[model samples]
Target: MKKYILDLPEFILVALSAYWFLENYIGTNHFNPYAFIVFAMLLLQIYFKNKYVGFLLAWFISLFSLYMVLAVISEFRDFPTLISEGALKLLAFGLGFCFLAMGSAVLMFYKYFPKVFPARF
Candidate 1:
């Protein structure tokens, strides 16, 4: 059960990646580049069963989360616009923070358990 809990982040990432791919396919009728990377990471994780794979996935998510934080902060300069948007902006901000927190937790796990997340190269 503890091991399953530790693997939860990877599972969440895989589910989110699949949803994003489907959303882009159905809604935009185009391929999303990030979806390819997500799929690759998922496959690699399954093949290797290594914590390093999870770290890589978390790193990718963290980068995106950081970008989202920057984008939201820039939008904040137009505070009135955000207010006019109502709950949508708030919801996005909340999700961004959640992603940031999850990313940080994954990184800390790798940092503290270096032997568990050995470098493949």
Candidate 2:
């Protein structure tokens, strides 16, 4: 068990990170609706003393969090138009709407996908 957990394949970690990043990019969410699957699987792994699974989950979560931080920075720097007081009121509204959608998507993904993560971890 230690061997499996300590020697996790790099490809799998990359794959999970890429999946999460791509999913977020397409929908403005920091994570996908399937992200929770990975999370729950991670918890199970820990309960079962699977180190590899926990590592994988941690890596993916870090990647997802990093991406979210980047997105926030990008939005803040580029959405200045949305911050201007009067002329961009409508634009600000639209941006707010997108933010809400992104937040909801991430929350939903975590809520739903944690159960889907495989026990192999």
Candidate 3:
């Protein structure tokens, strides 16, 4: 029998982080309906413990998150409007959102496609 909570794959970890980041980044409740699908697949990956399946989910999430970030930027010229209050905080939050999306994409590519990153530390 295996442990209840074993170490997840690097891609899974990254995907999960990106998922959580997106959860917090979104302003409205239930704004993204597809996020629920990603969350469910993540749960499936955890249950099955299949690296390949996890990789597929992670890749899909990374691409989707990148697409979302790009789409938002193209649609909105400003960060949730140029609010005079807490502008710095909003900027920081926006930067974090972009960074997480980009990080997910870069890590997914580097770790899986090119195998630039080692499988395990």
Candidate 4:
């Protein structure tokens, strides 16, 4: 019970990574190499139980989420303009939610499982 609670954040991170990978693979017409790389790194951590791999995966997720948030904010600065455009509004909302979810998961891991993250040499 206590162990499961502690591991919840890792489970969430894995789920989110899988979802994002599938979203990129099937949601878009073009294949995204970066998404594939993320998915692969996450799989390595999940199957190998490699602490260094987990650290690298978490670092990548955090950085990517930050980048996504900044890119979305810069692109969708005009909220009123997006609201007027039906599909664009929906797209913006979806992207924002994805980035927020990823960001929150990374934060949770950092706060609760700090030791799991490896230090850069």
Clashing pairs in 1: none
Per-residue alpha-carbon lDDT of candidate 2 for residues 1-24, written as tens digits (9 for 90 to 100):
855444243224344435555768
Top candidate on TM-score is 1
Using all chains and alpha carbons, the TM-scores for the candidates as numbered come to: 0.66, 0.36, 0.49, 0.63
Better of 1 and 3 by TM-score: 1
Q: Which residue pairs in model 4 clash with each other?
A: none
What's model 3's lDDT at 91?
Answer: 51
lDDT of 4: 0.64
lDDT score, candidate 2: 0.49
Model 2: how far is 63 from its true place, Å?
Answer: 1.8
lDDT per residue for candidate 4 within 3-104, as digits (tens), equals 566456556666766777788778886677866776676556556656556656666667777777677766766565655685476567858666665765
How many clashes does each candidate structure show, in the order listed? 0, 7, 0, 0
Candidate 3, residues 1-121, lDDT tens digits: the string is 2242232344444475557647755754444555555566656655665656645655776776677666555545564665545555555565566566556545544434533334574
Model 2 scores worst on lDDT over the 10 consecutive residues at: 5-14
Across 1-121, the per-residue lDDT of candidate 1 in tens digits comes to: 8777666656666676777788898899998988867777776775677666555556667677677666666666556665566546665765666574466546535643565645789
**Model 1 alpha-carbon drift over 4 Å, by segment:** 75-80, 85-90, 93-112, 116-121
The weakest ten consecutive residues by lDDT in model 4 span: 108-117
The ten-residue window of minimal lDDT in model 1 covers 104-113
| Alpha carbon RMSD to native, model 2 | 13.1
